[model samples]
Target chain A: MSWQLGIEHLRDLARGAAILGTGGGGDPLIGRLLVEQAIREHGPVTVVDPDELADDAFVIPTAQMGAPTVIVEKIPRGSEPVGALRALEKHLGRHADATMPIECGGINSMIPLLVAARTGLPVVDADGMGRAFPELQMETFSVYGVPGSPMAIAGEHDETVVIDTGTDNKQMEWLARGITIRLGGVAHIAEYSMTGAEVKRTAVPRTLSLGLSIGRAVREARAVHADPVEAIRDALAPTLYSHLRVLFRGKVVDVERRTLEGFARGRARFTSYDGTSELELRFQNENLVAEVDGEVVCTVPDLICVLEGDTAEPITTEGLRYGQRVTVVGISTPALMRTPEALAVFGPSCFGLDVEFNPVEDRAETPAGVATSLAP
Target chain B: MSWQLGIEHLRDLARGAAILGTGGGGDPLIGRLLVEQAIREHGPVTVVDPDELADDAFVIPTAQMGAPTVIVEKIPRGSEPVGALRALEKHLGRHADATMPIECGGINSMIPLLVAARTGLPVVDADGMGRAFPELQMETFSVYGVPGSPMAIAGEHDETVVIDTGTDNKQMEWLARGITIRLGGVAHIAEYSMTGAEVKRTAVPRTLSLGLSIGRAVREARAVHADPVEAIRDALAPTLYSHLRVLFRGKVVDVERRTLEGFARGRARFTSYDGTSELELRFQNENLVAEVDGEVVCTVPDLICVLEGDTAEPITTEGLRYGQRVTVVGISTPALMRTPEALAVFGPSCFGLDVEFNPVEDRAETPAGVATSLAP
Candidate 1:
C-alpha cells in the first residue's frame, strides 16, 4: 500500500533532504517539483520495507552518474532510466522485482521513486550509500563486493548498452564517464543487481525515512522558530546531534576545483569571523573532510554537511563561496558506508588526508534511536 | 582477388602511414607488427578493388577515437573491434557484408584489417577519408550526413558502449569524449553504417592502394639512386600528387606539442633552409593542415604528409622533433570532404585557418599521375 506524505510534510521533507543531501544535490526546488510532479501524475510510489521484498526479488539500484555540470544541461529524456532497466532485463532475460536508490543525496534519492512507479517495481526502503561520495564504486555495494558492471547505460537516441567489464569499479566509472562527457557529461545507469537477501545485508535500509525524519525535524524546528539545526539533531536522534565544536566558517576565501584523472578534486578555504581560523573542505562531491588549521576535524562515512547556519540550506562543495555563514555539522554514516572497503574509498586517504579512519561513534555518541553496527 | 605487396611495400606503407597519421595515431610500429604478424599468420590481407564487393554489401567502417596519449598506455585488447562490430550487427540483426577503414592513417587504417582477419568480414578497398582530420564529422560519411552517435565504443576492459544521441556530429563528439575521458582516455569504435551504394558515392575509394603506392615509391626510390622525394611523388600520384609544392628541407630548430580541448594542438615552428617557415599541424587523430609562409598551402580533404627529405622515412606529426630535416608535401582531398557539409568540419576554416579551402590544383601542379578533380 502507498504511504503518502501530505503537503504539510513536503516542505520539511525537502528542507531536511537538502541537509541530508550534503550539498551535492542540485537545487531542492527542481528536485521537489520533479518528485511532486511524479507523485501528482502517477499517484504516490509505495515505499516498501526491505523486509517486505521476497528473498529472490530482482532488485536493481539506479542513478545518474558523471559530472553534475552536465546533468543540468542534458535534461533526461524521461524514459532513459526505465529504458535502461528494461534493456538490462532483456539482456539478462528477466525483470527486476524491486529497485533501490544508489545515493541518498541530491536527485539521486528521489530518482528511484519515479523509476519504481514507472517499472511497477516496489521502491526498496534502502540505498547503496547513505550520503554522496562522488563515483559509482564509492558505494557500499563495492565495499561489499557488488559488481557495478553488466548494468545498462542508455542515450536519448535509444542506444542502450548492457555493459559488462572485468574492470574494477573504479575503471568501469572511467568508461561510463566517456558516455557522460559525450552526452554532454552525464550518463544514467541501471546497476547494482542483487537479491532481497543481498539488499537486506548490504544496504542502509530506510535511510530515506531517516532523511524524512531529519527533514521533518528541520521543518518542525523552523515552524516553532526553534533552531533548525537542533531540530535535525532530534529527528536524526540517537544517530547524531547538534554540536558546539568551534571550527571557522565564513566566506570561502579561496577554492580550487579540478577534475583530474577522472576524479573531481579541490579544496575550499574559508574565513569565519574576521578569519581567526580558516575552515577547509576537501571533497569529491559530498564533503569528505573538514579541517581546521592542519587537523582533520571530520571525515567520510560520516557526514561533513555544511549548511547556511541561519537558513539550514545545504551547500555544495563546488559552490562554497566567500563570506557565506556556514555551520559544518557531522552525522555518522548509516551502516552501509561504514564498512572498511567503503571507507577505503571515502576515508582520509581517498581525499589525500593522512589520518586513520575513526568510526563515527568514536568521535561522538549517536542519538538515541538509530541502529548502530557493533564493531567486529 | 588478392593483391601482392613485397616487404618493401609494407615498409613504405608503415612509414607513409605514420607521417600521414598527423600526430595522433599510435606509433606505427604496433600497426606494422600486427600487420606483419597477420601476414606471417594468415598471409597478407587480400587488397580488393573498390568494385570487388557486391552491390548490396553492408559496409561497416571502424577506428579508434579518444586522446592519443592514453592509447599507448592502455593497449587495445585487440579483440574489441570485433566485439563492437558484432554487437552493432546484433543490434542491426544482420551480418556486415564488408568492413571499411574509417581513415587512411596510423591506428585507423590497420584497425579494419585487424577486424577483417578476426571476424572474417571482407575488407572494403576504400576509406572514409584519404588522410586524417580530427573529429568524427571530418569523415566523408559525416560530410554526407552519416551518424556518429550510434557507434559502439569498446575498451580493453571489454566494456562496450553503443553511443547514439540526437545531437549532431560535433555534439556527438563532445559527449563521446566525456565517456572517453571517463574511460581512461582511449577506446575502440566500429561505426558509420552504410550501404554499398553509399560507400560508392562518398568514400575515398582505393586510398589504401594509394598508401601502398606511396610506401612502395619511398622504398624503390631509396633502393636505387633515384630521389626518394620523386618516389614519394609517384606513390602519392594522381590524387595526393596534385600539390607538388615542397615547403622546405632543413633540420627542425624547435618542436612543441600540447594537448588542448581534447586535441594534440601546437605548432612545430621549424628552421628550414628556406629561411625558417613554420609548419602548423593540428590534429584530433590525424593532421588537418600544413601552412607555409603566410600562404594557404594545404588543408583537409588534402593530405599534409611529412617525411625525412633525404630518406623518405615518414615522420609523424606528434613524433616530429627538433634537428630533423623534413619536407612537408601536400596532397589534395577527395571531392567527398570538399562539399559544403564537409567543409564545415574539415576545411581551412574548420582548422581555424583564415584562408578559404581551395583544391590542390588551384594551389600547385603536380609532376604527374596525381588525380585532381580540378584536372578533370
Candidate 2:
C-alpha cells in the first residue's frame, strides 16, 4: 500500500520523529517547516511501503550528518539533501526509483521527504533504524550486512563528495563526520544504497506511518484534554513496540551541557515539585541512560524520551532547558534490536553503564536480576 | 624536451624538494624510498616538460595531504596516489595521459612520479606551487584562475572521496584536510584536473629539474668535501631563483614542538659557537619565518631551508631537534609567486605577522627597502 504525505501529515510525523529521536536527532522544528514547504511547492510525496517496492527498485537512504547544536546555527540549506541524492544517482549511473530515511529520528526522519519532493521520487515507508542512533554503523542495514557505500555527500555550495569506503562503515562515518565539520558543521548524505529487495530484507518496516500515527495520537489527545502520554501508549499498542511506561514527571532543576567531540553531551536533572523524588538523564546527542534516585530505570536499545509535561511536546537533547516541567517515557524497542548481535553494539554494556540489560517495564517491577529478552 | 627520472634523479629531486619544502613538507626520506621502490618495480618514469605537451593533454596533479607528523607514523599504502589519479580520471570521463605534482614541496614532488610509475603515464616537469603552502587555494593554478575540481582524494582503505568545489578552492582544501585527518591522518589527492594548455600557462616550469639539480649539487659538493651551501647557491644561480644566501650556521640550543590544528608548529633556536648571534626559525609544518638576533631575515613566498651542518642533509620542520648542528639557507622564489594575488594569499600579512614583506634578496642588502622586480 502507498499513501500521499501532504502538509496534513508533516506535523504528526515531525512530532513522532521527535519522540523517536530519544532526545537527540536535533530539534525537528526547522526540518518540519522545510518539508512542509517542499511538499507544498512540489505537491504531495508518495510514500510506498517496503513490501510494495519492486525488487529491482533502486532505493537510496538520505540524512543530515553533524551535531544538533551546529545544525541549529547552520540551519540546513534545504537543497543539499536533494543535491546529494542526485549526485549519488549520477555516480551510480542509475536513477533512484525510491528514497528512504537512514533512521527514524528528529530531523533526519523528514530529510528523505525533502529530497523526494524535489526529485519527484517516491519515498519508501521504512527506515534503517526503527529509532535514531548516533553513528552510521548502528543502522539495521549495516548491522544486517549491507554496505554503507558507494555514498554521496553534498554541500549547499554545489560541492559534492562521493565516497566508496568499501566494507568499513566505521571509516565511512569517520570520513563523513570529518567532512561535515569542515563543510561548516553540516553536510547532507545519501548512503546505504541498496536494491529494493535488500531494503525489504533489512529495513524496519512501517516506521513512517508509526511515527505519523504516534504524533497524531498525541496531538488528538491534547485536543480533548486527555493525557497525551496515554495516547502515545494506545497508539503504539498495535506496533512492534512492546512496552511503554512513564518513568518520571518533574521539573528540570539543572542542566549541564557541553559540546564534546562534535556532539552536545551532559546531563539533565529533574525533581518532583514535592521534592521527594529525583531523576537524572545523561546523554550523548541522544539520551542514553536514565535513573531515578541512583536506581537505573532505563538504558539504551530501549527508548528514553523527554517531553514537555503540559503540552506533550518532545524536547530534544540539545533543546533541554533548566527549570522546564517535563515527563520522561520509556518504550521497548523492536525485537530485532534486542538480539545479541544488536545488543553488543548498542546495549547498556556498550554505553559503559554498570547495570545489566533490563527491560524498562521490568526494571521498575523487579529491581533485581531478571532474564533479559536479549540474553547475550 | 623530456627526460627520465632514474634512481639517480630521485635522489636529486628529493633533495631539491626538501629545500623547496622550506622546512615543512614532512621529511622526504620515506617518500624517496617509496619512489625508489616504485621505480625499481615499474621502471623509471618519463618526465615531460610542460611546453612539450599536446594542447589537449589531460594533466592531473597528485600529492599527499595531512600532518607531516602523521605521515611519519602512518606510512602511505603506496597505492593511494595512483588510486586517486585513476579515480579522478574516471570522474573526468577521460584518461589522464600524464601526471604532475601539485607542488615542489616535501613528499608531494615525488607522489606524481609514483603514480606515473604504475600507470605508465609521464609526469610533467612543472608544478602548481613553485614551493609549498599549507592550503590548496595558495596554488599557481588557483592564482592563475583554474578551479580546484573535479578532484578526487583516496585513502588507504580504498575509500575515495571525489569532490567538485567549483571555484571555491579554499572550501575544497578545508574538505580535503578534514577527510585526510579521518583517513588515519593521511590521504592522497589528485586535484586541479586541467588541460595541457592550462599546465603550460599556469604551472611553474622546470621545478622537477630544479629540485633534481639542487639535490645533485649538494650531493656532489659533499662527495668532494666542498661547502654544500655554496653548492646550492651555484645550482640555483642558473634558475629563476635570484639569490641564495647562507643565513646562519649554529648549534640548535632550544626547540619547541607542538601539533596544532593538524600541523606541527613551533620555533627552533640556534646559537653560534661563540654565542654572539642567534637564529630563530618559526614554522607551521614548513618554516614560515626566520629571524637573526631579533631582526626579520626571511619570510614566506621565498624559500627557507635548514640542512644538517655536516652531511648537508635537509631537515624538515617536524624533524628539528635540540642539540643538532645546522645551517640555514634562503632562496628567492620565482617571479610568478611575487604577484599581488599570490602574495595576498601567501605573504607575511596573510600569516598575521605585523611586518611588511620585503624581497629576501633585497632584505639583506637594503634593510630599509628596495623595489621588487615583480611588483604588482
Candidate 3:
C-alpha cells in the first residue's frame, strides 16, 4: 500500500516513533518541527510500502547521529540530511528512487520524510532497525549483509564527508561516530544504500505505518480520557512487538545523565508511588536495560520505553526528569531482531550488560493482577 | 627541468628534508625506508619542476597526518599514500598528471615520492610549505587561495574517506584531523588538488632540490670532518631561506612531550655546555618557537631545527632526548611565507604563543665572533 504523509500525519508519526525510539534517537519534537517546515515548503511526501517498489529501486536510508541531548541544543539546519543524500547519489552515480529511515524511531523516522518532501522522492515504509539502537552497525541491514560504506555524512555548515572504504560495519560506526563528534556532536548521514529486493529481504517492513498506528492510538486515547498506556498495549497487539507490559509506574527519583562520546548516557531511578519498590534504567542514547529493585527484567534487543504516566507521551533518555511521574514499558522485539546473529550485534552483552538475552515476554509476563491495577 | 630521484638520492633527500622539517613532519628515517622500499619495487620516480607542468595538469599533494611519535611505532603499510591519491583522483573523476609533497619537510617530502613511484606518476619539485608546520591550513596553497577539499584520507586497513564540500581550509583540517585520530593515530591524506598554474603560482618552488642540496652539504661536510651545521647554513645561502643561524649549542636537560589531539606536543629545554644559559624549544610536531634565556629568538613561520651537536643529523621533536648534545638552528622562511597574509595563517600567535611575528633573521643575527666559535 502507498500513502501520503502530510503535515496532518506528522504528530502521530512523531508520537509513535518516540515510543519506538526506546528512549534514544534524539527528541521527536525537533524532528517534527523540521519535518513540518520542510513539508510546508515542499509539499507532502509519498510513503510507499517496501513491496510496492521494483527490485532495482535505489533506496538510501537517512538519519541524524549523535547524542539526543545535543540535538536539543544544536538543531540541524534541515538541509544536512538532503545534502548527505545528494552527496551519496553523486558518489554512486545514480539518483535514489526513494528514501527510508535507518531506524524507524525518534528523529530518524522523520528524517526520511523530510528528505522525501524536499527531493520529491517517496519514502519507503520500512527501516533498518524497527526500533532505535545507538550505533550504526546495529541495523538489521548490516546483520543481513549490507555494507555501510560509500556512506555520506553532512554537517550543519554544509560540510560533506563520504566514507568509501572496505571497512566492516563496526569500523564504519567508529569512524562515523568520531566524525559526528567533530561535527559538533551531531551529523546527518545517508547510508545502508540498498535495492528494493535487499530492502524487502532485510529491512523491518511496515515500521512507518506501525509508528503512525501507535501514535494515533495514543492521541485518540488522550482525547477520549481513556488510559493511553492501555491504548499503547492495544496498538502493539497485532504488531511484531505484540507482547507489551508496564514494567513499573512511579515518580522519577533521580537522573544521572551526561552527554558523553556523542551519546546521551545516564541512569534514571524511579520509586514506586508508595516508595516500597524502585526501578533503575540505564541508557546510552536509547534505553538499554531496566531493573526493578536491582533485578533485571528488561534489556535490549527488547524495547524499554519511558512514557508520561497520564498522557503516555514518550520521554526520550534526554527528557527524563527528577520528579516526573512516568511508566516504564517493555515490548518484545521482532523475531528477526532476536535471532543469534541479530542478538550478537545489539544484545545486552553488546552494551556491556552482564545479563544474558531474555525476551520481555518471557522475563515479565502480563500478570493477571498487575494488568488490572492500572488507573482507569 | 626534471630529474630522476633514484634510490641513491633518497638518503640525501631524507637528510635534507629532516633539516627542513623544523623538528616535525614525522621521522625522516621512516619515510626514507618506506620510499626506499617503494622505489626498489616500482623503480625510481621522476621529479619535475612546477614550471614543467601544463596549465591544465591535475596535481595533488600527499602526506602523512598524525603525531610523529605514533609514526615511529605504527609504520605505514606503504600503500596508504597511494590509496589516498587514488581515492582523491576517483572523487575528482580525473587521473592526476603529477603528485607533489604538501610540505618539503620530514616524512612528507618522501610521501609524494612513494606515491609517484607506486603510481608511475612524476612528482613536482615544489611543495606547499617550504618547511613544515603542524596544521594543514598553514600551507602556501591555502594562503595563496586553494581549497583543501575534495580531500581524500586513507588508513592502513585501506579505509578511505573523502571530503567533498565547501568548507574552508581550516575546517577541512579539523574534519581531517578528527578522522585521522579515529584511523588509529596515523593516516595518509591527498589534498589541495589544483591545476598546474595554481601550483606554479602558489607552491614554494624547488623545495625538493633544496632538501637534496642541504642533505648533500651535510653528507659531504661530515665526510671531510668539516662543520655540518655550517654546511647547512651554506646550503641555504642561495635559497629563499637565506638567513640561517645556529641558535644555541647545548645538552638537553629536560624534555616534556606528549602525543595529544593527534599531535606530538611539548617543550624541550636545553642548557649551554657550560650551563650558563637555557634554551626552551616549544613544539607541536614541528618546532614553533625557540626561546633562549627567556627571550623569544625564533618562531614560525621560520624554521627552528634541532640537530646533533657533532653529527649535525636533524632530530625531530619526537627524537629529542635528555642528555643529548644538540644545536638549535633557526632559518628564515621563504619571503612569500612571511608575508602579512601568510603570517596571519601561520604566525606566532596562530600557535597560541604570546610572541609577535618576528622573522628569525631579524630576531637573531649572525655575529662574527659566534660564527668563528664553531670548532673546526
TM-score of B chain for each model?
0.87, 0.94, 0.97
Candidate 1 CAPRI-style tier: acceptable
lDDT of each: 0.66, 0.84, 0.90
- Cα miss at A276, model 1 (Å)? 8.3
The DockQ values of the predictions, listed in order, are 0.44, 0.82, 0.83
lDDT of 2 by residue, B117-171 (tens): 8889999999988987777777899999899888899988788999888898888
Give residue A30's lDDT in candidate 2 (0 to 100). Answer: 85
Q: Which window of 10 residues has the lowest lDDT sum in candidate 2 chain A?
A: A367-376
Task: Please give, for residues A1-376, the per-residue lDDT of candidate 3 as tens digits.
Answer: 7998899999999999999999998888888998899999999999999999999999999999999999889987789999999999998888999999999999999998989988999999999899999999999999899898989999888889998656498888988898999999999999999999999999999999999999999999999999898898999999888999888878899999998888889999988776677888999999999898878889999999999888989999888888898888999899999999999999999999999988888875423215445433
Query: Which residue pairs of candidate 2 clash?
Result: A23-A317, B24-B286
Q: Give one digit per residue, the lDDT tens place, for model 1 in B1-376.
A: 5464334456667666665564556555666666665656655566666677666778888777665655555667577778778767765667888788887777777777777766666778788767766677667777776675567777666777665554366665665565565566666777788888878877878877766667677777778868776776655556633445454455566666665555666666554454534555555445666555545566666666666767767676567778777766666665666778878877778767677777756774322212111111
TM-score per candidate, chains pooled: 0.84, 0.95, 0.98
Q: How many residue pairs clash in each candidate?
A: 37, 2, 0
Query: Please, what are the lDDT tens digits per residue for candidate 1 over residues A1-376?
Result: 2354433444555665566666665434445566666667666677788877878888988776655444545577566777778777776667888778888677676667667766667778778777766777777777787787777887666666556664377776656655555544555678878888888877777766767787767666767888676676666666523232323345567878775443456778765554456667877756777776666666776777787766566777655776666666777666556656677876677766777777544653222112121111
* Candidate achieving higher TM-score, 1 or 3: 3
Error of 3 at A246 (Å): 1.2
Best by TM-score: 3
